[model samples]
Target: MKIFTARLRQTQFEISAANLAQCPPEQGVEIAFAGRSNSGKSSALNTLVDHGGLARTSKTPGRTQLINFFRMDDNCKLVDLPGYGYAKVPEKMKLEWQAHMGEYLEQRQCLAGLILVMDVRHPLKDFDRMMLEWSQHQNMPVHILLSKSDKLKRGPAKNSVLGVRKEIKAYGDQVTAQLFSSHNKEGVEQAREVLANWFGFEKEYETAQ
Candidate 1:
């Protein structure tokens, strides 16, 4: 088949919204990347797009407090959601963020799927389970990116993947996962293929020349 890939490399910073009302029009396919703070979500995003600085990576957790959007083209976009489970934030602010995120997740009609990132060493925490539950409620397709796979040995990493798969199996086929590493670009192609499929990129078989 002649693969028609989404031009993710050409993605540009679009806008940041603190609430759903402030976000751009809900028209295009948007795949959102979400995770707990310090899960390397931003790094994974940058790696997926082959852009070093697409999403800002920070040593401090909870750096992303807004919903950031990156435009791949006129009809496709990628969203960066604020990281959850940052302990230092005030309770009021945390609740506000949660409300905003919930609003977006429940109301956004054009959101195609969600990329849930987690550190390979600490996969499926309470926050991750909460996200999974939310996804199940929404019937949204979710791709779990087990980020920072390089930290663990191959056997352990594979085992982690298997464990995650088993844990999420009850959620149904709408949810899928794989190990990913921003540092080494592991599973970048696999992730991209998922995105491409979600975005409905053209797939045409090549005829005999």
Candidate 2:
């Protein structure tokens, strides 16, 4: 249980498209967490780096209206894309999400990879599919963390991961299928290994740890 430590670091809200576009300039490496509304994305982020409650969690879907950025040690950034599948938000607002996310993913240069987290029991919904397609279109690397896997039994959980792996294989992504749990800290180390290797810092990470 020797987990890594990442403190609050710095968190800044980006409201306008202009601000979001300018975020990646300084952050040496960037990894993003994206999924449908209320998909446990924020919780996993807080758990991953041992920073509790980093991103706000809400029962209300689509609450994260803008792309929020949190800096770590002034070296890397954690990008939180807005949650899709809004039930109460206006049409114009939902439209804005599509445009904002589309622009960011397609244009960002320092985007090392994306953590496409999905609920294990209900992996790869419609909006998740669209996100996968976008990643393929942009040729972006993706690491899929099947969040909330602790809720499922061992047999079903592994089966779900296998199922998603087979389905998204055609995208030719350097993808991984791991189960995550904030409550019990499952998948924490494996995820760190994934990110460290993806960003070419695994050697340093291991050496330091």
Candidate 3:
């Protein structure tokens, strides 16, 4: 299918929500990107949309402590969820963030799919497994991006992807994975194809011959 990647460049920041109550109206499809702190989530998102400053990357681990939404169109959006695990925040604040994220995951009706980003060097930590289990329970489709692939040699990066696939096989075909590099733009098109498919844009274009 031909997914117009150019349209993704049009994505603009819509709003930020500190809690579930602060989110916009739930009327459209939302694809959320979730990962632990310093997992390169923001970089991956910025690269995917071909925009340098769309998702707001930072040197600090816990800088993105709110739910940031980017509107792709009238009925489509990309959500950057608060980073979890190892953010230098206080225990009480971390707990509050976790509660908010949990509520957003469990209660959001418009969430079409999840793009779980993980650092290739540190794949599938406790946070990642928790998300996998939750998505499995909810029967939600998840596409895992082994981000920062450029940091590793090709052999190890490919192995990481293979290992993750084997580990998540029990969760069924709804869960998929791929190696990605925001720095080098490796696998950007592949990642975008997954987004296009999940966003239902594949139906809007004719299949490639």
* Best by the TM-score measure: 3
lDDT of each: 0.90, 0.76, 0.92
lDDT (tens digit, per residue) of candidate 1 on 40-112: 9999999988788999889999999999999988888999999899899888888988999999999999998
lDDT of 2 by residue, 1-209 (tens): 23323332234333223235555464577788898786788888877766676677787777777777777645567788888886788998888788888888877778888998898998989988888888887778888889998899999999999999999887785666788888788898888767666555655567887
Candidate 1: pairs in clash: none
**TM-scores, in order shown?**
0.94, 0.86, 0.96
The per-residue C-alpha lDDT of model 1 at residue 78 equals: 93
TM-score of model 1 vs. true structure: 0.94
Q: CA lDDT of 3 in candidate 2?
A: 31
Q: Please identify model 3 stretches exceeding 4 Å from their true place.
A: 1-3, 206-209
- For candidate 3, lDDT tens digit of each residue in 100-128? 99999999999999999999999999999
Q: How high is the lDDT of residue 92 in model 2?
A: 87
